[model samples]
Target chain A: MSKYLITIGLETHVQLKTNTKMFCGCSLKFGEEPNTNVCPVCLGYPGALPVMNREAVKLTVMSGLMLGCEISRLSTFDRKNYFYPDMSKDYQISQQARPLCLGGGVTIQTPAGPKRVRINHIHLEEDAAKINHYARFSGVDFNRCGTPLMEIVSEPDLSSPDEALAYVQALKQILVYAGVSDCNLEEGNLRCDVNISVRPEGQEQLGTRAEIKNMNTFKGIYAALEYEIARQLATVARGGVIVQETRRWEPDLGETQSMRSKENAHDYRYFPEPDLVPVALASEQIAAWKALLPELPSARRERMVAEYGIPEYDAGVLADAKENADFFEAAVRLCSPGLGKTVSNWFMTEVMRQLSVTGKTISECPLTPAALAELVELVDKRVINGPTAKELSAELFENGGMPGVLVAKRGLGQVSDSGALEGFVEQAIAANAKSVEDYRAGKKAAAGFLVGQVMKLSKGKADPQRVGILVAEKLARLA
Target chain B: MSHTLDVAYVAELARLELSPDEKRTFQLQLETIVNYVEKIGELDLAGIEPTLHGQALVNVFREDVVVPSLDRECVLANAPERNGFEFKLPKIVEDA
Candidate 1:
């Protein structure tokens, strides 16, 4: 609808959840005391040689396999030259020419259908230290230095802000499901850099782009894109040309500001890192890693829908988090074979609601899957009414207990016997003569009041459905 | 023989502030070293793959395990300035 076409590309950096740093033996921990994880290798001392971590390499290769990337047989590290206090090292050891993975794409669901966003490459690198800015000076914490990070560079395949959000969400889901990274945005486990440009409609040549750096949240990325896109469009509308430079997203200000101009752009003269040797991966090792990969998030969603006969929406909600999907599967396995939809219904309504109200994740849920299965089975067998079951649901979610045992201990089972229902109906009819006369006078709605009275007399354990049928039969016989 | 070295540009990249006299002196010295290194171009190395290191080593890695790091006080002993537990530097104007 506009006079220009916009293109967006993202460079996402995910910190791998490894036990140790990438090039050193320092433990990789978050929120630890600053500088406690410092070592000679990570501190970039004069004569410290960096040794690569095997687990870091394996995790990177596993991620590539999950994303359908081409595993590079021979990958090498290069030194990206820069001068910054955050990196203590004058250069960062990263992959420039030969990276670990190449040419894979993530399929993001769009309004039209599924769209694939092409990936340029995924390279392994080390994270820099944390810097806290003060009024007069800056403080640096080297605890985060040398932590393994993967930079996933995407091609300019996304055209809108919504597509970008979906792309990032999809990628994060896959990474989390693969167990490569925690993908916690709040903890700075995953960060994003967005490069966006705008060109006139029907223009073949791409316009100059502005790069927004170091966005840590999805909402922040989407907001930055909307602002930057409009800013470029306004610049072009007034016959101004777009300049290629780096910018920073000011989430508080809701705009992107120029961080540096193009004249001061970094010229990272990268060359082979002599400290670390090139990684030559055998074909068999790549195959072995591929075999070890678990079922990724996308595949699990489809399988859950097909195997469980649940709606696609339910499958998506359950698969949004790995722990949620795992809990759903565990509960379904404990229940009857064909009651997946029933279990999913409870999850969609009572289980999720209880979780939200209690502020707990599926992993932190106190109720066991076995208990949930038993509760569902009780309801299916007419052992408990809906109201009584719902009341017990709250109790079970708060403090877990066996549903069958709790039913017996509290006498909460529904009374569905024909004789017992007839007795309760007889008492209600004898007590409510006015209601019976009104029912005979063509006031059919009064039967509901009589059913309520029967429920109260039975102390809320009587099955309301069967009582309704019994009450109608008695009223008809009297008429 | 067709190689051209831009001394100023290379110095800028290395963040070195070189004097004109030093630049002129180093230019010849670097050219001499490069010319000597270029002698290998004459050899028939068509079948050989490019090598990045002197030793024939690849996939040399250590197991991922935590080893005790240096104590914080020892780590910060060499800091020019420290604020409590962190290394402090002059206020930076540019974002890293």
Candidate 2:
């Protein structure tokens, strides 16, 4: 393919983490008995008035704070007039002109290093129900209706499918870490639509953009863009011009097909909803939210690198997730800050290994921060050598335990005191007489025999390095 | 003067079967709504901020956790017919 810079923007619709749906008191849950939780307001029965939910607003503000976005002091809902069986009102009340959040970004780590994807805005609205269409008749269930959805629009900043996937992953990490949203794509909590346009290399102007929608997974987004890019390039090579349109990604075919033309059918009749008043937030209110803003991923990653002296790569991994960063911070506090490098290493290796195997987040991890800190303490205090400590750690981390208590109960104390270690070394030298003779006879591999004997005498608690050093020193006397 | 939608096509798209009298009456009402919007557009909005929604955008999402959905019986109870849980319908196309 000829050199072309692809510009991709994303519109992500996430169901808010509210206990109740917007405009109605229906329970904000995924799996419930069909149409059981719906009420008159959500069902669009005449004479029902929608009372807005306040918890939804607070959660949106929390999300905005996490993303470093400016909260709109004044906001109002508008009726987006449309007709569908899934929507009882035949119109959706959504944010149109001014949104709840504006001007925020998340930094996604890509192969090209850190890239900031600026979010244009995140707006709140109600979700439509699912319509099961049949050959002649159709069915609608209001189970999904009234569910609060936050539509986040990102600026046209990303250049590739990989970058888009990275951006989504980064956003999910922050949202989940913030406890703002669960961001589950499989459960339809978080869904993505990509706006992509490709321009000739070094061209100042952008090409016509195609909106590819309903790519439910990260891989689907990347694959859809890859397919669309190739298709556009092939069309241009054949002297065909690319027209702007809305496309749907077909995962089964690995292709993108145009759903509708962009020059057509896009005028949504947007008007303010009369049922609610315009929401206003004072400067003091916004300031209070600003103060509540957490250490974002970028800031936390930088601090982790500088304060903890962790390597930049490990810092990025830790900061990629909110809970992971929190876990790292907790470990640093509970253990010693000097153990930062070791903590990072253990988390990146053993902790990540466990999280992946059990499919759990650091927040949902069965192992606690204090428990892990104790394991690291075992190593530092020389109560258990590195290899044996790892074995104990795996056991403790997998099956939960207090390391200090476990070590005391199991009698697996390390022989770090030179006197105690020498006793074990002396026993090894007495028992491995042939090995000591082998060492004096110039068979250097004989020292390994003495080290093993020392380990057996110490009950696997003898430090390997110290064992080797003491074995070499004691073997020298035999010479 | 303002542009009011014909609504006939939109009605068709919605699979509605409206009579001539309803269409004519709706046209007049639609024109009234369009003219009202035209008046709003003509207002001096240079300093007035446009309000998107009454609620601030909340970044709410469910945990990507999946739970058991409604059983097929409950799901299809509202359906006219079903091939087990699936809603069955008439043949979309007739044989050539």
Candidate 3:
């Protein structure tokens, strides 16, 4: 068997979060009644003209700046002629010859180290209307038509499935941080198509590539690439030729089937759109959009590691989403500098667990950063033990309330008083006589049993460390 | 002028249902038009800038603001076929 190097490229379409349609004044909202937002301009009625939306162009420039792409000073929209029912117009107005952004790359952190995936260009276009097919007839919803969409094309710089996943994740983080798009895969706000090929080891020429389309999730993208690469490698190993085609990923079946061959490709006769004039951006305006880009994910991740002394892995997780990273920073700032790692651990473990269960984002979390800091402080001050703090965190996660007030109202405060814990310790020894005998009979591990008994008697409100010492003291009296 | 026009291919791209006679007629017409347009290459306009459009207007853009869309009945009135509030088409076996 011969080892082959896998090559992958990704083309992602992200719908920009704009108030209006790309070329019209229809509201760019999702889940509206079908065709309710349609107008003459977006519906492509005869004699209707399209005026460019300024904000959409500004957002494309912002995306270009964030991705380190060269902003094209003069860009224009071209009509891509195709026969699709999705677009009411036979032609889609898109940027082809001159796109809004050119030549950028996103650096992803692979296990081997940092790898930069080059982006060929980013173009702006209007999204096609959604088609919902039923048993016999298909319905066309024009609500999504004419929404500003940014299509980002990346070079074939990825070598493995993991790198491809990391590349999409990194790009998504930048898009979110720049506030260019919502980038929600489930909402069809973001869609990815991957082009993959494999060649024999040390081969200079690339193999024939297959493009996997309509992958809406990162996991699906990873799985489709893995399955396709294996299929290609096996075909080549057996002397079978790999055909250049497009495949649709059936996620449930965990395999890709041929969708269309290269010969059936559409010839989109592109011409400059005459309805809209060329956009000429000033240098000052470009500089202003560049300055408007927020601190990107990579910079935030590096700073989190340097400033908070968190592990690189933890920083990556914390800074993956801008909202979660902002929440961590806000909570850390409310606490002492030494508690950075402690605060990060709470977010990574408890907060993330709750979020996964509820399907809510960190921004939608009920617990505020200040309240989380207060809960951590209560644990530090011995007002509550570790177990009690976790319980309060669950409570806080459910209901938005102050951690201190919840502890006080529920009487969950830790009982560190020696008198109170000593009584519980004596009661535990009396109750677990067999365990006491085991302790005296050279079973040193029996002390842990007695301490657990004391915790049970105190209903977990007793400080665990103090209970351990008190249990030992009471046991020593028997000796 | 040496290039031949494939009118059938163009008709297919434009989704036009043309007969064989129409395709042949269009082929001849497109070739004539292409030959005529190719004459512009003979001009000695080395320093002249190519005009993108006839109008001198540039940078015409509308502010990003929401305007009222047409009512559902009015918008759907022009559709050749409609089902309830949606435009009804034949079952599309293909996905974009």
Best by TM-score: 1
**True lDDT of residue A122, candidate 1:** 98
Task: For residues A1-479, write the lDDT of model 1, one tens digit per residue.
Answer: 45889999999999998999999999987899889999999999989999999999999999999888999999999999888888887889999989999989999989999999999999999999988899999899999999999999999999999999999999998998889999999999999999999998999998999899867789999999999999999999988988888899988999888985434347788989998888989999999888888788878889999999999999988988888888888889888788999989988799999988988987786888888888889998899988898888888898888899999998899999989988999999999999999989999989999999999888999999999999999888899
Ranking by lDDT: 1, 3, 2
Better candidate by DockQ, 1 or 3: 1
> Mind giving the per-residue lDDT tens digits that candidate 2 earns over B12-93?
6455888999988888888888887789877678988565445555322233322333444654566676554333554332
What are the per-residue Cα lDDT tens digits for candidate 3 across A392-478? 898888887889998888899999999999899988888889999999999999999998888999999999999998888878989
Of all true interface contacts, what fraction is found in model 3? 0.78
Docking class of 1: medium
Residue A375 lDDT, candidate 1, scale 0-100? 89
lDDT of 2 by residue, A256-330 (tens): 887743232565567778776766777887777667667767778889999989999999998877778888889
Off by over 4 Å in 2: A1-3, A109-114, A132-139, A201-205, A260-264, A416-423, A430-434, B1-96
- Highest DockQ scorer: 1
The DockQ ranking, best first, is 1, 3, 2
lDDT score at residue B40, model 3, on the 0-100 scale: 89
User: Global lDDT of each model?
Assistant: 0.90, 0.78, 0.89
